[model samples]
Target: MSDAIVVIPTYNEIENIEAIIDAVFAQEKAFHVLVVDDNSPDGTHQKVIELQEKYPERLFLEVREAKTGLGTAYIHGFRWVLARDYEYIFEMDADFSHNPEDLVRLLAACQEDGFDVAIGSRYVKGVNVVNWPMNRVLMSYFASKYVRFITGIPIHDTTAGFICYRRKVLETIGLETIRFVGYAFQIELKFKAWKLGFKIKEVSVIFTDRTKGKSKMDSSIFSEAVFGIIKMKIRSMFTKTKPHA
Candidate 1:
């Protein structure tokens, strides 16, 4: 069995689910994919079930009863995968926004190098984003900057969903205590890892806007990320967070 598992959360992603699964399998490096589907009404889970017949060992699925937050889906994936012996765990989007090709680069950062966490960063190298409007681009780029100033995390893209975490990093950060089920959820995980003194490396990756499906980004999600960081920082002061070994 492969040591790496990429946890992809899905909700009405039928347009891209089958293609993304095939793309991930096409990667040179072996990576097992776990689709945490939120019972996509568009039959996303059915597509995964059909493909499982072909790649049963490499592709797995966990269908949730309702649409929860992205953070909760990943937490479920972490617990499910951790029960096994996988060393590397990944979080990626079902949309084509996050390229499957970059999976190799992300895995390399933690597998070949000594970094505990690897991020597929867009702002790390002059905002490497494609097909996004200037305003949306600015909002995302500056959001990372704002998160850095507020949380003191050194990484450029704190809200990047395409990420790789060594088993030790996930094992260090308590998945149950993770707050903010929206965009802020991404920031919360990174902040906890930083506070624990884990090594984080950002590898440059181009984020393309998904053309096939609707975007999940909403104003409330952005607001949650902006305000949630402040509360997280305040809580960290009074709380005793555990560090990785």
Candidate 2:
């Protein structure tokens, strides 16, 4: 078995599911993939089942009963991987927004460079997003900036979903307590990791908007992120703990 596993959370991603799976498996590093698919009406989980025959032990699937928030889906995947022997656990998109080739770079940050968490950052070097309208881009770019300003987390891409976490980081962070389910979920994880003194590294990457399938971003997700940061910061102050790493 490979030491690394990429956990891809999916919902109604039939258009991109098969191709994304192939791109990830084609990588130079042997990375196992566990797809945590919320029961999609589009038969996305069925496609994964078919591909499983071809990939055998490398590709795995867990179908939840209904579509829930992205954070919970990832939490489920994290628990599943933690139960096994994998050392490197990743969070990636079913869409091509997150480059499959960059998986090697993220793995290097944790495995070779000894960082606890590696984020595939869009704003580290500059805003490296493609195919998105100017307004949406600004909202995302500024959102990260706002998060950095408020949370005192030095990360440039605090909301980036493309990430690699060394297994112990997750084990230490107390996954059961993770709040926010939308974009804020991304911010909350990074904040907690930083507060716990985990070393996080951002690997610059180009984030391309998906060509297929509908985008999941809505006003509620954005609003949650905007308001959630303050609440998170307030909550962190009262709680003090020793670093597990």
Candidate 2, residues 76-138, lDDT tens digits: the string is 999999999999999999999999999999999999999999999999998999999999999
Q: The CA-based lDDT of model 2 is what?
A: 0.95
**TM-scores, one per candidate:** 0.98, 0.99
For candidate 2, what is the total of clashing residue pairs?
A: 0
Query: lDDT of all the models against the reference?
Result: 0.92, 0.95
**Candidate 1 residue spans exceeding 4 A from truth:** none
Q: Write the per-residue lDDT of candidate 1 for residues 1-245, one digit (tens) a residue.
A: 99998999999999999999999999998899999999889999999999999897999999999988888898888999999999999999999899999998999999999899999999988889999999999999999999999878899999899999999888878788898888788999989999999999999999999999888888998899888889999999999866666
Give the range where candidate 2 is weakest over 10 consecutive residues by summed lDDT.
Answer: 236-245
Instruction: Give the number of the best model, judged by lDDT.
Output: 2
